[model samples]
Each structure stands twice: as structure tokens, then as C-alpha cells.
Target: MSLLTDLKHDEQFNASEKAVAQYIITNKEEVLNLSIQALSELTYTSPSTVVRLCRKIGLKGFKDFKIKWSAELQKEYNAISNVDPDFPFTDDDSYGEIQKKILELFTDSLNQTSQLLSPDKLERAVELLLQADKIGVFAYGDTYLPALNFQNKLMKIDRSVHMAALPGENRHLATNFRQGDCAIVISYSGESKNNYYITQLLKQNGATIIVITGNPSSHIASLGDLILPVAESESQSVKLSTFSSQTAIDYVLNTLYGCLFVSNYDKNQSKRIASETLFLDERF
Candidate 1:
């Protein structure tokens, strides 16, 4: 929990400490620019009392409190509302405004993706991956970014995942994969002809297919054994870039990677470091 949260509910604080806490919480904007002595003066408390309150929240002194508190304030400030992911900023927007809008879009996309996530589907997907004889990921273009990322992390934990980023190369994986194997198809639109051909081959070979796409009703999504929704608050083509879809895809894949790691936490955690040391020389 944050220091502010502790101040509001930590019952051990006495009247003087509570008064200092109240002043800090109420005058957050002022506190951002306040010194330790100035804060004590405003709360009508001694400097020693302010230091005590800081220690109560696990901080060493007033400087530590101010730096952490400033970060919390900045996080709250970035959480804006009603920001359309498509065309989030105008042509005339300044560089700082563009940066803020992009951050807002990412925050909004992560929330939306979490809302659409299904616990049952997630459990089932993880179970299939755990039992699969082999695993392959099919993605091209922008979606290939997350496919490559997932493959990298999974490899560190000793889960070998095949991902072919080049066009004709993925066809080989789809065609050669076996009946008990698993295939993850990442296509934001769920209507890519490129993905559709490979999807057919995977189905023909009796591989279990997991689809991550924006449109649940689209052709590719309809073919999957399990479908996970993609958060697509932005337009498919008329937008500045593939911001929302990419963010949501990365979020979903990362969540899957986390769950996979936790399934065998102790071994996986140690194995990751061992893998890095064995395969990488400069990691330290």
C-alpha cells in the first residue's frame, strides 16, 4: 500500500501524527513543494513529529516521503478520461501533449483488456499449453512483435515456442505441427487472409488453436478452440498508429507468461536465472 493509504487507516497513529497526516493528504499540491520544516509549521506540529509520521509509513525522512509522493501524484494526473485511442492527439498538439495522450491511451487500453479477460478461458488456455506436445505462434506484421516477446520469455523458463515472422516461413510451422500440438494465432483484425490460410492448415493437422483478435465474430475467431478478446479502442486503418491493439496484445501475452511462470514458481524462477547464465554471458 501507498504511504497515503497507510496514513488514512493505520490505527497506531496518535492525535498529533494523525493531524500531520491529514495536512499532508489534504494539501497534496502544496506538500509537493513543501520542505520538512514548512510542513511541520503548516500542521502546527514539531519537526520531530513530522519525522515520526514519515517513519510510521516506513520512510527514513521527509525527503523520501516527498519523492515517493510526487510519483504517486504524477500517476494520478496521467489517468485521464474520454481519450479516444484513434486520433488521440491533433496535428497541432505539442510534443508534451502527444506524450501525455499516448500514455493515457495505453492506460485505458490495459484497463479495457483486463475487463474483457475471462478467468475460465485463461485457465483453460494455460492448461492446454501445459499439456501440449509442441507450441507454435503464428503472427505477421505488427502482431509479430508480441509473438516474438512471448517466445523469448517462455524460452527463458524452458518453454520452447516456435514463431515464424516471415510470410512463407509460418506456413511450414502450421503445416508440419502435429495433432496434439498448440498454435497461438495473433491477428488483431481476425480477418487476415494470411492468418486464415495458416489457421486452416493448423485445423487440418488437428492442432488446438487459440485466437486473440478484436472481432469475436470474425472468421479466424470462429475457428479457434478458445477465443480471447483483444482491446481495440482505436480504428483499424484510419488512426495515427497501431497503439491500442498493440498495447492490448502485449498485455494479454504478458499476463499469460506471468501465469505460466507461477504455475511452477520455485523451479521456473530459478530456472530462468540459470537459463540466462548458461545462454547469455554479459547479463551480469
Candidate 2:
């Protein structure tokens, strides 16, 4: 994991450590040139606190932390300088430029997500899905499409998947989940109150919950039994479109579908082919 990702995901850091981390993240370029005492003074902490923060993040000391952080920052700078993932195209961009920018946004989003994905967490999520008696997918707004797509994919493989976009219907479906069942919740911010309540309801029923979210520190993420973290560049634009989050969610769901399909490859392939054949026959 990158130091920034680790700082975000790891909750063991105390207030002082987090403060130091935030300072380092915000002042990445300047950190490499600052002495331990200088950094501590800048962050309103002490040199010992800085050293402790470094140790907590798996670095030997301030020097090692600077070295690793500098390298990571350089890589990030080079990547973003090529194509700004968050705002790849502007209002004045030409048609061809817009197309190219959109492509770059999606490609970079997937690559960043892939780099941060944890194989162990993915395997565990698949195991939970395979063991569940029923699966419920939950999402709101723009994320609902990917959730529905995942439901359709699972249904093709003969898995019972349920999803509800409405609040009352979501609650109803969540309430029906029992022990040995699983709920897959998709939310980029992981702060939707509706999804939070739904996840709470699933927990109340003793069902396992898998959360696919971009924010690791969100409340919904904390409630998850298994979390699929999606890394993307943060954006504050009020644009109607959400590019990176949706792409990340789709990629994670597709990866999960692939893993599930391969777990029982022969049976799944037969079922999928048979389903397609039946549909074609009905249509023709």
C-alpha cells in the first residue's frame, strides 16, 4: 500500500499521528526538504511524535519516511501530469479531445484501483458470497446501475440476488436477509444514510455485509464485514457525471463476478450458455 493509502485505511494512528500524516500529505513536496524538527514544528508536534508517526506507518524514522514518500509523490506527479484524471476535459475541449480524455480517465481509474486492491479481501468476499444462502445488492442514485448489473450477472449463474433502489423496498429486502445471507452495498462516498440504515438492518439480521466504497473511513465502510476499496482521484466538481467512482465500482463488481464464475466454472458456463440459448429460442 502507498503511504497515503495506509494512512487513510489504518485506524491505529492516534490524533497526533494523524495530524503529522495530514501535514505530510498536504505538504508532500516540502516534506522531503524539511528536517524532523522542522516538520514537527510545522505540524505543531514534536520530533519524537514525528518519529513515532513514521514508525507507526512502517518506516524506520523520518529519513526513511521522506525517501519513500518522495518516491511515491514523484510517481503520482508523473502520472497525473500526463492526464489529470479528475478533470480530464474542460468545457472548451474539442470532440476528439473529450473522447481521449474520457478514455484516459477510465483507464487511469482502473489502474489506480487495481494497484490498491487487496487480494486477500477479494478472496474473502468471494468466499462469503459463495457461502451465502442469498445475496442482496444495495445502492442509491448513480451507483444503482452497477448494482443492478452485478445482480444480473449473478442471476445468470443461478445465484439468488436481490436489489432495491427505493428506501422502503431496500429496508424490506434487508429485513428479509437472515443468517448465512450476504448484502453487497455499493456507495462511492459510503455516507448515504439510507444505505447506512440498510446495512444496520442487515447486521441486525446476522447477515454478512460486503461494502464496495471509495472512502475507507466512512461509517458504511466501518460496518462492512468485507470491504472492497476503490481508489480514485477525489473531485469536488458539481458536474452531473461521476466518472471514476462508477468505473471503479463496475470494475470491482466484474472482478467479483469473474471470481465467482471460475469457482464453479463448468456448472456456471453450462447454465449461462443454456440461459442464452433459451432466450434466443424465445425471441426467434
Best by lDDT: 1
Write the residue-wise lDDT of candidate 1 on 96-156 in tens digits: 4567788888988998889888888789899989999999999988889988999999998
What lDDT, from 0 to 1, does candidate 1 have?
Answer: 0.86
Q: Backbone clashes per model, in order?
A: 0, 0
User: What's the lDDT for candidate 2?
Assistant: 0.84
What is candidate 1's CA lDDT for residue 49? Answer: 91
Candidate 1 regions exceeding 4 Å error are: 1-80, 276-284
lDDT to native, each model: 0.86, 0.84
- TM-score of decoy 2: 0.68
